[model samples]
Target: MSVEIALTPQNPTHAGLSGRLVCFPHAGGAAERFHDWISGFAPVLDVRAVTLPGRGRLMDQSPVESWPDLIESIVTRLQPLADRPFAIFGHSFGARLAYEVTRALADDEQAPNLLIVAGPAPQMAQRDRKISGLPRPAFLAEIEAINGTPPEVLANTDLMDRMLPALRADFALLETYEADRASKHSPLPCPILAVGSDNDPQVPFHSILGWRHRTRSRFECRLFAGDHFFPFTNPDFADTLFDYVDDALNEHTKDLHRAG
Candidate 1:
């Protein structure tokens, strides 16, 4: 028997731009967390952040357990947005999910123009598991150390109680993901832009370099000055990302002119 997967659809907000950039959040992240960055991408790219189940507005829904299931759901939901010049930007767990989703789309002969894998290594070995097996206090301490969890969320016990389950569920997904050798490191036709932080403990420098083998298209890697979640801490990270996007688009234009 075949299982049907249901994905929560978010209405795309009008951005008055021709291109679309679909962003996936990190583990335990909500769609709203990316609104500011989306706004920044609005001048040149129509930014739409995926709202996955069991978080934010979809808090009541159960989180999907398996990676294949999650990727299938996302690919189905995102098919409509593939018509225009589109790109994907995913961080950490979201980066892995984005890579899987991109592969699935490519299998169907639908691939994005650009893929930005930020804050995560491509291979499973490089990924770390710190939060999955931790006790409650230890988990909270880990969150605190990351500095990504908001102050209000940390201060309010009730809010933390409500959010913890979803966070844990996401962590479970990351911890349990088994790498498929058959699907490992297939070369993509589109250019890939890798973003990493100098201080990110979860992703090693060599692991980030492994991404080069996954794509035959042009590849660029940039190391920003900050920790694991550099975009959150550094004010200039968004500007740097935008600059890369602009350069990629320009290069695409040049390629088109040459082909014409």
Candidate 2:
């Protein structure tokens, strides 16, 4: 499957101002999901929401099945715009994907300044039940139980038809993923911000704490007031994320000035 994502805001050239933030979407999510939040990043930051194939305009294309291939595809396509300082953010499955992409960029001199992950955390706990192969009714029930999918989409047959394939492919990607054993290896160089919810039905507390072990630089966590979907559902997500980036970038500026 030849899959390439044309990130929104295309070139992302920063004009030597602030860094750009590249956002990856959750399972069955498209890049357009972050459209409303781009303005929040404003002049100080450039934001690019990656649109994976197999949804929206690319509905006819086959979704990439292998995680490595998918990561490489994203990294290859993103290399052009990575000229200046930048960061990467993702939610749930996208979070892990973002991390892997960061790893792929490891050999490069100019890596992401920070990483922000929401919804799912890295985990040691194993899932007792698998949601991937469940019957149609059961599958929808599981997705709904976790509050990851909207009820309106479930109610619409046409929408469900378009959504299920991509959802299943994303689930399979997660199933095949081999989580990084932070203790066994060196942590990533950039700081990480792990965002979660007190009541996220899908991702547990261990998931949040796992991020601490994965970062060699700095690590921060923010817990919001909703469930698994809080990253996108909460009205204040843009403000919260923006403030964190602002603070991080500001400190980065100071560090650069000090070194100079």
Candidate 3:
């Protein structure tokens, strides 16, 4: 698949950016999830949001069910753009995918400068209750419990109907991800930043801190005030996010200069 189809550029016309920020959305979320985030980093970075199969413009296509296939497709499509200094940012389920993608690109000449994951930790042991296989009603209830879905979407039955298939598929992917299998690999060389909420029921504070184990380089975890979807819900999220990303990008540029 072409990278054009796999990514939706948020600031295509912006020029002279030194780095790129590739964003991956939460489960069942489309590229639009990062639409509001474009303005923050557009001046310094080329921002592109991932468009997974079975959602948004690719709604007609079959959702990728295999983890390895999904990762391979993303990595393959991203290779062309990976030539530049870039950062990978993902939320919730997307965070897990970002980690795997970073691992796959670890040896590339222009590997990601940083990896930013939000809303979930590297540990999957906490999710003991598998809701992906539950019937429709039960599945929706569990999704609601996560508090990631907006109230407007939950209230609209027709929209909910259209969204269920992708939701179910994504949840199944999350449920099947084996943490033990992932941990066997060497830790990433790039720095990692984990963002999470203090009151998030689905992912606790300790869980957010657990990401420190996944990186050989620097690891920092930032805690905000909100529920699981604090990335979108918290008022201070945008400023805080941009500040961290700016520092990382600056450091990456300095490293490239030293290497040259």
Candidate 4:
């Protein structure tokens, strides 16, 4: 279950943009994670990075539960932007949400043209066993073990205290998320582009292949250099996304031309 995250798009340009690319952040991540990086992908794709409550721009706000409510709220806020062709991109924890949201909109006008699931594959995706409910020390350790959380953030007590709620909320969202019967058996019609890093423990090369089962249409997998957070560490990671987006759009255009 993709939790109910109350992230309204902050970028006004999304309303009039041609096609939307809704990017969901990893666990404990803020919308800014992909927002600033996708400046180059603008115009062609209106990339809207989801800003959940209690982190990033919404740090002052209380975090909502990562359950049905979060997913419902995300759908409600993102519905209007589905006027044109769109893609759903999620990294690590965000990947599940993207898939779930796509399933939620299976019959609607908001159905995504493609799903770019980055980082962990569904079988071994980023969901810890109830770290959200763990004690402060244990929770922090788990986050650190994931290797995605920076050392500076862990070192800074003030920052950790402030961001702890959002982190825990996101963890809980993934933790309690059980694959429903429909999502388990029913594969999405849209194509899926699964991406991961070869060296990343969270996303083993073979594990990424499991995404093939989740899609009824096309499935493509690409591995990059670096760890799970390659997007942040390697600038080339952004290029990969752009390339995939361009390829998908081109294929879609060909399909449309043939149809006409």
**TM-score for each prediction?**
0.84, 0.89, 0.92, 0.87
Candidates 3 and 4 compared: the better one by lDDT is: 3
RMSD of each: 3.4, 2.5, 2.1, 3.1
Higher-ranked by TM-score: 1 or 4: 4
Clash pairs of candidate 3?
Answer: none
155: Cα error in model 3, Å: 1.6
Q: Candidate 1: list runs displaced more than 4 Å.
A: 1-16, 125-135, 142-152, 180-183, 250-260
Clashes of 1: 0
| lDDT comparing candidate 1 with the true structure | 0.73
The C-alpha stretches of model 3 lying farther than 4 A from their native spots are 1-5, 10-12, 107-110
Pairwise TM-score winner, candidates 2 and 4 = 2
Write the residue-wise lDDT of candidate 2 on 4-86 in tens digits.
77687643444556567899888788877787767666667778888777776667777776977897888888788676667
Off by over 4 Å in 4: 1-18, 123-128, 179-183, 257-260
lDDT top scorer: 3
Location of the lowest summed lDDT over 10 successive residues in candidate 4: 1-10
Top candidate on TM-score is 3
Query: For model 4, how does the per-residue alpha-carbon lDDT over 1-260 read when each residue is reduced to its tens digit?
Result: 43344443435654555456788888778776775655777656677788788888778888876556676778877787676677888987788777778877775646788999875555455454667888999999989997757677789999899999988887776766664443365778899998888678867777778889888999999878888777667779887787777667667767777999
118-181: candidate 1 lDDT, tens digit per residue? 7545554432555756888999887777654666678889778777876777677766665545
Against the unseen true structure, what C-alpha lDDT does each candidate score? 0.73, 0.75, 0.80, 0.75
State candidate 3's TM-score: 0.92
Model 3 collision count: 0
